[model samples]
Target: YAGPLLEEEALNKAAEKGLSSPEFLELCVWLGSQIKSLCNMEESITSTDGGKDVESFQLEVSSFLREMACPYSSLISGDIKDRLREKEDCLKLLLFLSTELQALKILNSKKMKGSHLEKHNEVYQEVQTICDALGLSNSSASDILPLLTNVEQKIKDILSKVQNNHVGKSLLTKPLNSEQVERLGKINDALRSEYECRRRMLVKRLDVTVQSFGWSDRAKVKTDDIARIYQPKRYALSPKSTVTLAHLLAAREDLSKIIRTSSGSTRENTACAINKV
Candidate 1:
């Protein structure tokens, strides 16, 4: 019976012993799902010669879950308590993944020139919103903000898959357990710290590069300014979402080419900005 084909005799024997054992209730819930797979769902409840008693078994398991939810009546509504009976731990994890995927979509929409900082802000807000609403520990906004992604298409794919799994309206997503929440928090923290360290080094490199291109004090762009100008958007926003700078840059209009002819100083500043990256 454990394999694909269930022998009539073996199934009958299992039904007899299983119904009388301490694990009878658990067996009933499993049997319902198994019956759903089998061709004879109706016959399962009707006593068959092999020894399966389907009707009483289904009733007993349904009552067991209902009784387990009884003590919390004062706090939880009847509808919610019933749903808790069927919900599994994995369902909550899927729900969290769905939320983050949505956040990624929001970040992807913000990809553009000079919008990296703003994108970081929004992604951070989304992450914090989930954490707060779900009673997850509040993480550092600045540190988490940089984790956002701008990859729209990839996240769209993932979100689509997750949504497909969220079929029913009934399976309640329990608040992420403490361990799961903390693990995600630590991941965000570690990633943000790593990104911050990388940005610092890049800024230093940018400073050196800018100084070498000096025309005048105003002509030399700061590394931080360069990052604002050319550092990849995904790298810029962290702990919030992921998006690459190149992808957004390609989609942006080439406005620099349209700027009118200017005086020497103006030309130099504009040239520096355009050529640094």
Candidate 2:
């Protein structure tokens, strides 16, 4: 008997003191409306007359249950109004109706989900048909965007090359005289010297700025030397080296000593003992 239509406190109160005639009628009307909407019925079987009495409410509830093809529709009859006056009977009826309504809502949701899946399938089939008409491979659908992007990029590149060639031809149509060529060479030399001077000035300024920030190549080299001095070194075994019986006997003694020393000692102490050995 728990749902959006009924609150826990209200249901508890109804269980203690059976649902009032007006409250019962109101629930029945709400149930009828929900059933009609879920079933896609054009018209409601329950009456909406404001002056309806207890017997009319019961009859409407029975009709709604029957219309929904409820298995327990027989439980709701003309005498249901009297039975609902008792707290136990009212709770039983409420539970039954709530269960039926919840089932209907679940069924309707599943039906809507199935319809949505069908629509998605139809769209996929339409896309597949269009791809077939275009003579595209079945796998092309997955990579169509990448293929189109590649083609567009290639077209842009071809256009750029054509534009560059046209500009080159236009320039070549007008030849330079020997005097003009000599003047151009002199100007090029002057620009190159100016560029070199500016580049040197920029490098000097960068060096000064770095020194002001206390950063120097000498300091970096010193730090690297200190790190190398403190770092542990690992030696690799030579491929041509062979282990003799003495080496094996020494290893077995080291293992026995390590096991005895580590039994009750902390990891750091055990490591120190192993190092000493």
Best by TM-score: 2
The TM-scores of all predictions, comma-separated, are 0.20, 0.43
Off by over 4 Å in 1: 1-176, 215-277
List lDDT for all candidates, in order: 0.46, 0.57
lDDT of 2 by residue, 1-277 (tens): 2343377676657555544544555565676676676666543535446665656666666655565565653355546657456667666666776676788899989999999888867666655665555554565444345544554565566567675544222212345678966776676667666766776676666556544544566666565564454333211212222433223323432243435545665655656554767
lDDT of 2 at 219: 64
lDDT of 1: 0.46
TM-score of 1: 0.20
Query: lDDT tens string, model 1, 141-249?
Result: 4777333332343345556878654432322234456797677677766776787788777767766775675556664656567556655753554433343322333
